[model samples]
Target: MAQQKPTKVMKLYNRVTRLPYGNKIFSLMVSRMAPYFGTIRPLITELRPHYCECLIKKRNAVHNHIKTVHVIAICNGLEMAMGVMAEASIPSHLRWIPKGMSLDYTAKAGSDIRCVAEVKPEQWVEGDLLVPVTAYDDNDVVVVEGHIKLWISAKPPR
Candidate 1:
């Protein structure tokens, strides 16, 4: 009998990321923490096979003394949106990761932030996946916009 592969446990940036090593887990790990991963903590709101959304609130931890949302925090949210979207846009038999992220801060985010990343894999064949991200403030005002370019590997390039 073939032995069952034990479920993998992933630490969410440090805690809570556990159970099975899927693309989502990897992306979350990569996006959430590191000396270079920035310091803002992003919360994953939706995880779908074709897209995902994440959210984070503007607090002193992610704000400047002026109470304005920090630019880096916005970047973190962008990365999460991109990562989740990319994960959804790819086939399970395939592999890929983010190559670049371009962002623009349009307005001030003075409250909770929400980032949505959507994908259409069927619309893509052989090329980069451009996941457009739009972040909104509590009042539904557009606070940031960005695009994350992901290079889909031809194979499982672990």
Candidate 2:
């Protein structure tokens, strides 16, 4: 057969630079945490000027021995959300990378997972942006809340 068409996600990425970056960020995560997020495929569901949302369905592979979401998988969701939000908020002229992150997992993720990152870009100054990420379970319970700190690098890092 002829080559298959790229996915809808891939089609959308072609028209959006930030989304493509976020996609790359997700793909790169396997190296960031191989055994934990071994085949992480985050899909950007929504992206706008001030907000972003990504999603990853929960599978047995992501569950811990107790059948709860693995801690590292929660970390993966947190990072994906932050990346999407950062892509939406930061300008292409400026480069930024996540320097630090803080997370609190309050609830256990039990089913398909949703990661939402929302922020008021106007509230940030020139040097740093705090991307807030919230992950919820299938029942809409907040499983985790976190923030990713990104360092701006339009110029050389000081």
Report the Cα RMSD per candidate: 6.7, 8.7
| Residue 148 displacement in candidate 1 (angstroms) | 0.5
Question: How would you encode candidate 1's per-residue C-alpha lDDT over 34-129 as one tens digit per residue?
Answer: 333335556666665456667777779899778988877887777766665554445544566678888889998888888888766473445687
For model 2, what is the alpha-carbon lDDT of residue 25? 60
> For residue 67, what is the lDDT in candidate 1?
94
Candidate 2 regions with alpha-carbon error over 4 angstroms = 1-38, 156-158
- RMSD (Cα, Å) of model 2: 8.7
- Superposed by TM-score, candidate 2 places the C-alpha of residue 71 at a distance from the truth, in angstroms, of 2.5
What are the Cα lDDT values of the candidates?
Answer: 0.66, 0.66
For model 2, residues 109-148, the per-residue Cα lDDT tens digits are 7877778878764544457777888888888999888888
Query: For model 2, what is the C-alpha lDDT against the true structure?
Result: 0.66
Model 1: residues with Cα > 4 Å off, grouped in runs: 1-38, 156-158
Q: Write out the backbone clash pairs for model 1.
A: 10-17, 10-18, 12-17
